[model samples]
Target: MPVISPNTNYIRPSPYRSAAPPRSPGPTPEEPLPQPPPVVLDDSKESTHEPCWALDAIRYSTIVGAFSLTSADLKLLKKVPRGDYEDDDHHDRRITRTQSQILSRHGQRIDFGFGSSGRLKHRGMPMYALANAPEQELYRNMSSGGTAVMKPFSLRQIRVRFLWPLPRGEEPSHEAYDEWVRVDPLYTRVQLAMAVARVFYRFVEANRLYLSQYHDYPWRLRPDVFYRVWLLGLERVDTNVFVADLKYVKDYPNE
Candidate 1:
């Protein structure tokens, strides 16, 4: 029985003792991170600054006729400087308020018919030509004694002055004062010239109807002729920068 038991005593191996597979080597140390390119700052020299007040004046004059300008008109025409005004002590606001008051006054004056008074007076020139044709010698046969000497009608001259006030209580060396003094006149003149041109054009248009009534009166209604005459007179006048001699012509008829 002992021999039989020994023959049957064989041992079984455990299944839970299996070995693990090896892992891949960790990634080789990554190449050092690439450095970024250096940034370059510009160190160029700045150009010299030039004063703009005079340049602005010349520009204003070329586009707009040289004429007397109001404070409000000048303010409208001025090229306002660019900058932050939050810390400007409200000077810009004060000036704007003052300009508004002046504009209000101007509008009030216009409402009282003062704006068109001169225009109306000038518009009556055609009627004047009709009444005083013989005395004024406006036509070839127009004369007190039936003279036939050909002559043209005289056009009324409109002269506009360029007037603006310089700054007071400020030294000439101050930039603000210099700008105010130079820019104000320039802007005023430009605005005034525009205003004059508008008025003159309106006057011509209105007189066109009356001037057409007298077709036999030698002088015909020609806006181009009137404009040319005006330009000629303006160039001749030294005191007035804006002058127009609006005359009727015999060559052209109203369209």
Candidate 2:
């Protein structure tokens, strides 16, 4: 090789040299990178602003036991003829006397009346007392001296789905949806327990005709029986669907 001149420019690649491009400067003041929106964790504000789908159903149930009275009870009661005071006065008097006797036996002072529609109505009791009277009276009437001990119905594990009615042309945000997904199961469990208790009491009222025929045994809903009501569920299926897993135990003392 000819002698290289001292002034000759030569280039050589080094194995350790990186081939990557130079990094650009960080975000400038004029055109900064987009920062994520701030996350809010105010539960009270969130709850206050939360949609009413869940609350609406709960309020409806509390004000009226379930949505409507049991159809079985309604059908049975409707079969009775409407009262014509001149014709049915004796029958109404007999019914009122029987009701007074029953209330006296149970130590309850509330009076019962036949309305113009011929429906049985409580004259001097609160709405809740009337709603709960049947079951309570059944137990009182059955027990000897009202001192008999009966085992309460046992509730097993309850599994429920988180569902809420979506308003027309409205949708839940990701945060709200996630919150509901987290809390709905718990809320449903509590409401279901309350509903089950309410239904247990109402069962006596709804099935009074059938129960009255059984005089040998205690006239109450069988402790081991499984009673279900669609309205007792937290929300209507059209709005929210739920499943209540119930298991009854045979623990009532045999007479």
Candidate 3:
């Protein structure tokens, strides 16, 4: 697996814009609630998978077999298709095509660029459906013209930037410190997620096992630029692996 490349200077370039438009004068303009970081995992903390009779009893196939094997499996089972003979131009074109397709997909939220400090600035899709009549009215017009829903996709680096609690000169400024302590655990969980994602990217880049294939990794376009790309669970699906596999979940839910 191409893991996170060691070159810290290598910043991922943004792709298209997010599918969801920014919420302006809407969505309460409240800062997202802050959370904690994640606990690091080491070999000693890990455990073996439980024996599953289900694995033996069930015949799992993709929705009609997306592949006889996964890409990871291909990395092992098949020969690394000798590419020394292939022309670089031919391979480059194929990669570009794959990235273009991901960007053009209907519900994809592409991240176009970052702010001066490297913050993901714009989203590409329909604006959040504001309930304020005026704001909602604007969304309705955009939707009529076939606007995108919430950001369609996310980027690998984009993180969630929470709203700052107090203005720089607010009175009783230290009060929030007490509250911050209580939420330390949540912040830890989020950081753990970012750390794993950081590792995963290197695996992808180093081994050159690309999901994007050509363009940059298809991370979600959330508020933060270096955050996870997929939604955790806005809703539940019967067979989604994240829902089915508890261990893969990176959440530290706030009460």
**TM of each candidate vs. truth:** 0.21, 0.18, 0.17
lDDT of 1 by residue, 18-40 (tens): 11112323123343212212223
The lowest-lDDT stretch of 10 consecutive residues in candidate 1 is 173-182
In model 2, residue pairs whose N, Cα or C atoms come closer than 3 Å (at least 3 residues apart or on different chains), thus clashing, are none
- The per-model lDDT (C-alpha) reads 0.24, 0.24, 0.21
Assess candidate 1 and give its TM-score to the true structure. Answer: 0.21
- State the weakest 10-residue window (summed lDDT) of model 3: 240-249
Q: What is candidate 2's lDDT per residue for 214-238, written digit by digit as tens?
A: 3443212232122211121221111
Candidate 1 — number of clashing residue pairs?
Answer: 3
Task: Please estimate how well model 1 matches the true structure, expressed as its whole-model Cα lDDT.
Answer: 0.24
User: RMSD per prediction, one decimal?
Assistant: 41.8, 32.2, 24.1
Model 3 TM-score, 2 decimals:
0.17
Instruction: Score candidate 3 by lDDT.
Output: 0.21
**Model 3 ranges with Cα > 4 A deviation:** 1-91, 94-109, 117-150, 153-255
